[model samples]
Target: MFDRRSFLGSAAVAGGLLPLPEALSAQALAPVPLPPPDLYGKNEDAYWAALRRQFLIPADVVNLNVGTVGSSPRPVLKAIFDGFEQTEQMTQAGSEDYPIWGYGSWDDYRKPFADFMGAQVDQMAILRNCTEANSYIANGFDMKAGDEVLISDEEHGSGEMPWMLRQRRYGMVVKKFAMPKPPKSPADILNRINDAITPRTKIFFVSHISTATGVVLPIKDIAALARSKGIVSAVDGAHAPGMMKVDLNDLGCDLYTGSMHKWLFATKGTGFLYLRDEAIMDRVWNTIATGGYDDPTRKADRYMQIGSSCIPTLMGLNAAVAFANAIGIDRIEKRNRMLADHIHAEMMKRGAESWTSPDPALRCAIATVNVPPVQRMELQDWLWKNHKVRIRGGNPSRLRLATPYFLSKSDIDRFLGLFDAFRKMKGVA
Candidate 1:
């Protein structure tokens, strides 16, 4: 058995990542410092408005599609650029640029990220995106041909598509449960999932928040129920980390995956996966073989070693975590929730409708509105061309509004005014 001491001992001497450049050799893999927070302001509104200035998003464009992809802030971009520049300037001194190998100390990066998500340093694996993380769990997880995996109907493609592939490859039975658009209550959600479980059910796979309608599932309740039945819980949390407070310890899932770019506002191609059970390392196989592939002691690191990928993006991800921490996760969540409420109320006043739930408990920053079927495509084009309001469209045939912490009330009002005017022009009641 790998004891705690031995696991940490291996971590201390573990091949953490690639070697550092000569200029950064003195500091080695030290965590990047966050910019000053003097301008964070005193009051809530002022504080949020001040935060808006840190991004490079153009004033002319109002991006309500943060759910689709988030734009990195100024500090994160700088970290990426600085790290990439340093990497490009490396020269071969003797045998190699700098000698450390086998995935060397991303501990500096990993520690901050772990703390942000309420996870242990050993349990986290920094990957490219949620898709890769989901794939790692789906492919690595040991399942027999007749085993069943329960999933929700509202999950994103990244979360459910992998399970489909797994079913085809391993003959694993995949079962789908109905997820209410605006869940009536936690009990209501649990009942549906509970009803779907069978003797062959081995895993409960669901999204923490639905990408289609922004319904925040009762993950802890769901996880607890899965635990009672001896089923593994795997959550796709692509939209959770930055938009809301995420405490992995409290969430109680066997596996979790998220994207840094979607809401954490990290540079593109940065994501992470968390595993609650260490024994899973032995059962789960790495999709890509690397230096630590065979070392069972490496645990999560085995999944993280994907050859020499974008280290700069990881650096930016570290910076992004620091940025969110400095802002305070609770404050960010409160702001986003408030923004979502504002949009929902305004849309209702304008005779607008939503496919997403308006209940505060069921929703967060995302709000998807139903557009008239005839004008759905036209509304998307008009919003982009005339108003420069970027949002997602489809599924229930609606506009998806994701309120980033940086966005102001004025920006939302501007979009609402344009949308209201368009409705009037189209002769919609």
Candidate 2:
């Protein structure tokens, strides 16, 4: 039985703050019904434009950097504020006197978020961020000193650092394989990864989508291969959950971790981890053990047993998932991809060479282009300073444009016009 008094004492208000919403019970704080999105609309732009209104983005700033982080929409913001008030109020009222009953636990957000990601409810954990989730998997797995781990050169630091740390601590061998700039096909990706695997390989670590090149790797095939080889597989999927359809069971990875804030437009510091086999929960040692560590019934949630977290952020994450659900993932995927494709075509017309793969199968909502005429940093600064258009420009000297569902075709067109002017200014031959 939960000690109601202890829970309330731990959750008390800080700095003489006002009480949060006392009605933190499931029934009292039930999610509000979202407005129906009209699927029958013929004007796609108009419909998308209306949807864009729900966000608090300034009219003058065009954000093509959702791949880095997304701005939470109005509904999610409202939920955060409401959750804060409710939690404080509940703490003030004391668990004995409060009308509602049950653990107003962060775990309440788990199932709905799990459903959103096409994962089992019992297999999910409310982690701090993608990095934390990845770290949990890296440190938890029992690997021998000489065990081998294979990963791509394109992986983000978060994906690579954990293995590197393990290598330093455990003498694990880490190998980096080269991936084609524009992959030939799915087989091509699979073959490259397969060719790299050796008898000593214990784990195959890769990204669902490479943030640098914005290329969608063949995660399903890779995961299946790992299972056949008796090797553990983990996917650094920080970009996939909301930007695309992420069916973890279908993907078949032993572990998959991602951030809700990136494409999901959830509050910052919200992320999750999905473990395919619930039994493996005990094998992976908890990095930070807390109350739920010893309970076998806790399942995958044992990884999330950190002491004291922001309750409102977890509630905000639920709202973010609800917001995305209202739009429908399939529809969101299509709209976002269409925008990226449009940008890809326009960049090609401007004599820009794409760093991202040309194959539709290998590319999704993120498009990276190398504009040779002007320096990438110069172009990025010009766009942000002159046009207030925010896109990512980084290593390998390429500009990454993230086509979110909220972005319109007109916005991409405007970006293209500015890009062309920059090319002309540079006197491209």
Candidate 3:
């Protein structure tokens, strides 16, 4: 178990911040052990409950906002702390070897994540966050004046704004296709992309899973379509890495970027950019220039030459990948789908309009609904301040509920019950 005093004392020394509450401190300091392998076969519910102990969230609190960010679990935190302790000692075997990342290939850290994402180490570049990776795609990619980059209407600001910035500064064109509010099938989305493409379209850039409605786009089909037209395919997959099974080789996109911190439960500053091959790498210029940025022989490592960065964060990322592998991503994906399906169904029963897809293949982990007359901000505030339940949504209506594996069915039930009470309190049916 981590020492509570040490943790609290560090927080105090950092910024004179108030110490965590006793219950929260105890929860943070508690031992986190994985349940026995056989126990899952015997009692699945009990197995999940046991696994929940690994998280720092208090048992009484329900977190339905993992779409925004995830709390790092005990194992990841331990690895990060241990890394800091070992590296800060300033005792290296080699006289010139330093602890900082971003200079060398750092294959030990990059390979594990590359294997997890089904890519070779040469194709992966460990970046700071999804936004930086997106900027790399937008600003670094070779484009001429009036060369169009097509995207969807549902992209997050981080994904879309970079392109917008490029359009303002340079002379490139940015086009958008409106995604179906709730796509019933893959064809519904494919048709939109097909229609949106023009002769001048140089790049097909879109989100693998939309941040707005949590709808999973058909990336494989989109990539193929772009390939047939000789347009480069790039994806902003910020929410796809840990939320579902991602095989970049299978997806066959020219470029892909994602954040491990969102659903992967890794340290906050962990993200990556994947270039499909050397051909694509050659087309992209370096946004952050350093000594090795222009080195063709370095492959994907060339993109990682962005000054000095914390090595401990990469350690946390390795631990996160290990944790997910231990639990089995297939198992985690199933639980995510099951919980999301349950909540989506319950919301449908309550007459909420679905923003997420009805096709199970097009949705996972996140279930978005439009509950009109509910005042999303008001309900969000009421739930967190009064009920210890956390949620996120937009104005007037629209709830984007993210269901991670740690939550139980009863946790969903509690939220549903509270939803009824709140509706009644507001005199809405």
Clashes of each: 5, 7, 0
What residue runs in model 1 are displaced by over 4 Å at the alpha carbon? 1-43, 91-102
Candidate 2 residue pairs in clash (backbone atoms < 3 Å): 19-89, 20-85, 20-86, 20-88, 20-89, 21-85, 21-86
lDDT of 1 by residue, 248-272 (tens): 9888988999998988999898888
Candidate 2 residues 10-110, lDDT tens each? 45655355444444332223444434456326667777777777776777789999989998877787787677667766664544534221222345688
Lowest lDDT 10-mer window, candidate 1?
21-30
* Candidate number that wins on TM-score, 2 or 3: 3
Task: Please list the residue runs of candidate 3 whose C-alpha ends up more than 4 Å from where it truly belongs after superposition.
Answer: 1-11, 18-30
* TM-score, cand. 2 vs. native: 0.88
After superposition on all C-alphas, the RMSD of every candidate to the true structure, in Å, is 9.5, 6.5, 1.9
Question: What do the candidate models score in CA lDDT, each in turn?
Answer: 0.80, 0.81, 0.92
Q: Estimate each model's TM-score.
A: 0.87, 0.88, 0.97
Candidate of highest TM-score: 3
